[model samples]
Target: MSSVEEFRTAFRDWLRADLTGEFARLRGRGGPGREHEAFDERRAWERHMAAAGWTCVGWPKEYGGRGATLEQQVAFHEEYALADAPARVGHIGEQLLGPTLIAFGTPGQRERFLPRIVAVEELWCQGYSEPEAGSDLGGVRTRAELDGEEWTVTGQKTWTSLAHRSDWCFVVARTEPGSTRHQGLSYLLVPLDQPGVEVRPITQLTGTCEFNEVFFDSARTPAANIVGTPGEGWKVAVATLGFERGVSTLGQQVGFRRELEAVIDLARRNGAAEDPLIRDRIARAWIGLEIIRGNALRMLDGVSAGAPGPEASVGKIFWATWHRELGELAMDVHGAEGMLAAGEPYDLDDFQRLFLFSRADTIYAGSNEIQRNIIAERVLGLPKEARP
Candidate 1:
């Protein structure tokens, strides 16, 4: 077998053997709106994977990964999804922060954090979006000040996914008093368990609280925790965003396919597929999924070389808009039943939850509008958008 096929077979066989007993109950649990489900169990399962050397398979071998090639990494995600494995609890740390550290962090930072991330001993959350700076990360107003040996952070971050559960957060805060628009910012690694940090859960339309508003009042981390030079954090933060669109997203595409298949099956079972309009939409969804896969592969070429570039925005726009439309189609397949709760107090079936949660797919990470602007100015060399 080709090395890629061998790698895929090994992991596939491992998953087949391991996903039984209590772990079998975890399949398809804890993703997006359903993050509340089996979270502790999922964390334990991730630690189990870490123990078995199945986590972070794409990182360099020196960093404790298997040093899997890009093809093998893609296969790893695909097979993980094909096995219906539980949604990964350590993805934020393993995918986002780990790559960023490898690219920009000091050796000491890597020595201190990478092993913990590899082992799923520490969970991390992104501290990028604020009430005033959701998509425009340059507008971040959170500030951190170096005082003696540590940096004291004080600011509020909203839409922080999994913050309530994370052990640490990588924060982008203004360190220079008069700095504005990305300059003089620093990305600091802050512990979330400190007394100065308060995480308040925000219930979403799906009635889950995976997203949170985090208030950091004089929260502190060692001065050495900053990645890259203090004023150059914008560059480092952008690199982290690039890593956010990495190989693991292929696993997400698999989940998307599963959702599409489920929607198609529901339509068939409920006679909705008899409608020409429903049939057309289902076909369109299938076509869109194919396009999404192609765009993802094309985008990965850029990431494989280094941090991805403006072309990454193209994949983001395609998948986010397509997934949102799929959610709408799912609601339509449910017809009037979609509007009703599955039970009292806002309980939702899978389709209902998918419909509501996918509404934000285009809005978060970077809104559709912001992504279009990124492509226009960064990719096409168009004139910058008029700003006040």
Candidate 2:
């Protein structure tokens, strides 16, 4: 209920005062590529945040949220990044699944799930991308079949972030026999601790296993676990995707800004800034970032009306491509020294990890190719690309 400025002032004051002691040591300890570092410590910090009612500030008050305004939410993210706080471990739950449930989940579902997320008592991972279905979500072949009182699920999901640490996975599975593409899919909240589930870490180019391959062979969730009607999960799944790109994107920009500033500092320290091309690229990165902010703000301003439309694809393409390019610039700033690992068995510095991991920026969530297709068909009314 507070005005944006009031909320911002209070949040900034609280953050400055509270991020000290053991928490002070945790600053900048966890993030995208560095998730494997200090996880237990970061988890404790998140619990401290939950104890302070600092988690999920934007959900509905009825659902144990602060019901914060859009401006207040944006301010929270900006300040959190300004403090260089660790990337949250509950992101998939708090940002993606919580909102999706609020919009699509039944009362029983909401009551069962929302409080756990707000408290960070249960961690969740996205079960969307598969080895064969990463970019083309409609290609998901994870099949769940309804039995007497449970749905038995069998499928493999790859690039599943933090699945190794997650207690549950929100899985999209083919639930109807003979159905194809986007039809007959169901979003099931499956517990990961069950015997039928297996999680194998996939070490990336950064030499960290923040992602996993989740194999579900006869995994079971109660039949009541489906979020929408059994066969209408594409709609539910797409809504979750929209949340994945929602207000959190603004916070992500704050991290991007921090990374950019660090890259600029690196260039100056290493004398890379003296090169004319390096200077030009840095300037272009700044300008592109400005354009990204403008597009993202405009997109968010319309939230009162509805969820983001297809034009959201524009923001996705812009930022992902921009970040991937910035990663290249990060390596370029390091020059020849960038080629060597910081040590043995995959010891990489921050810049090395940034350069390697950002390669996936354009590929995950939705690939650049898929985003272009969505824009052309849904946003521009262009002819759909010919499908085989």
**Which has the greatest TM-score?**
1
Off by over 4 Å in 1: none
lDDT of each: 0.93, 0.91
Off by over 4 Å in 2: none
After aligning candidate 1 to the native by TM-score, how far in Å is the CA of 116 from where it should be?
0.4
RMSD of each: 1.1, 1.1
| Residues 100-191 of candidate 1: C-alpha lDDT, one tens digit per residue | 99999899999999999999999999999999999999899999999999999999999999999999999999999998897899999999
Clashes of each: 0, 0
For each candidate in turn, the TM-score is 0.99, 0.98
In the range 318-380, model 2's lDDT, one tens digit per residue, is: 999999999999999999999998888778888888889999999988999999999999988
Consecutive 10-residue window with the lowest summed lDDT within model 2: 301-310
| Model 1 Cα shift for residue 275 (angstroms) | 1.0
lDDT for 174 (candidate 1): 97
